[model samples]
Target: MERFVLTDAQWARIEPHCLGKASDPGRSGRDNRLFLEAVLWIVRTGSPWRDLPSMFGNWSTAYRRFNDWRRADVFKRIFDAVSDEPDMEYAMVDATIVKVHRHGQGAKGGLKARP
Candidate 1:
């Protein structure tokens, strides 16, 4: 089977979960694939939103989408969904202290620090 730029299966997986109506509802045939791609591009390159390529359909649009998702807590939800469950049984490690450094705070003052 030929691969689509935006695979239908992947689109289906995320489509239902995406929130918000595209800004231009009158001409609202906005594609979520582009939005997702823009977000990925921003993250992968760590670039400013204004630097997004024109092919992503205006940097302002992508920025608006990014801000909307951020305000709506969508990214947090997605992160939680994809992350492994927290290790509740994880334990904190405490160790006996050993002096590794001999740095002195005015050693001539003859004051010893209390532990």
Candidate 2:
């Protein structure tokens, strides 16, 4: 399987936000980059944690770390850190008219039909 590789520029932006760095007080993570890539692989392929490749290390460990980061809101911080201003060039939602069902519209006689 082709692994995801972070470009030097991309890594530079993401490295500081990662937990378990050498400078951090607690035990350092084995390899933040590899862990991130493993996560990316799982997300990109939409595979279960058990299907993670052996090269990425134990799936359970990776999953645990992922949960830790998620609880800490690390992913949101990373996105905010690295993202640029939103591009609104293209319309995200169409202006096409949508039919919405009114409350009790389908009832037998109308709003008073219900007993």
Candidate 3:
């Protein structure tokens, strides 16, 4: 499977928020960027952890790392860091569009008579 790529600028922005940096205590992560990409792949494709590609290493390890980061709120930190300056110039919402399910149309009898 094709993997995602982060430009130098993009990496620079998120690097500080990532876990297992050289400055972090304990054993450093093997490759934080690759690990993140693995997580992204699972999220984007909505695939189970068992389906993770071999290129990203063991699926169990990736899932464990994802859980560790999630429990630490690392993902929120990264989103906050990168979304500091969002471009809302073209943001929009279509309130006119609505979906009505078949069952929601109502039963044939508007009201049933009392027995």
**Which one wins on lDDT?**
3
Give the higher-TM-score candidate: 2 or 3: 3
Model 1 residue 97 CA deviation (Å) reads 23
Location of the lowest summed lDDT over 10 successive residues in candidate 2? 95-104
Error of 1 at 68 (Å): 0.8
lDDT of 2 at 90: 65
Q: Write the per-residue lDDT of candidate 2 for residues 1-115, one digit (tens) a residue.
A: 3545777788889999999999989777799999999999898999999999899999999999999899989899889877765567764665454544655467565456668
Q: What is the C-alpha lDDT of each candidate?
A: 0.68, 0.85, 0.86
Q: Name the TM-score of candidate 1.
A: 0.55
TM per candidate comes to 0.55, 0.72, 0.79
| Top model number, TM-score | 3
lDDT of 1 by residue, 1-115 (tens): 1333546655665665566447433333276667777788788899999899887889987888788788968778766644445566755555544433445543455458866
**How many clashes (backbone atoms < 3 Å, residues ≥3 apart in a chain or on different chains) does model 1 have?**
0
Between the candidate structures 1 and 3, which one is better when assessed by TM-score?
Answer: 3
RMSD of 2: 4.4
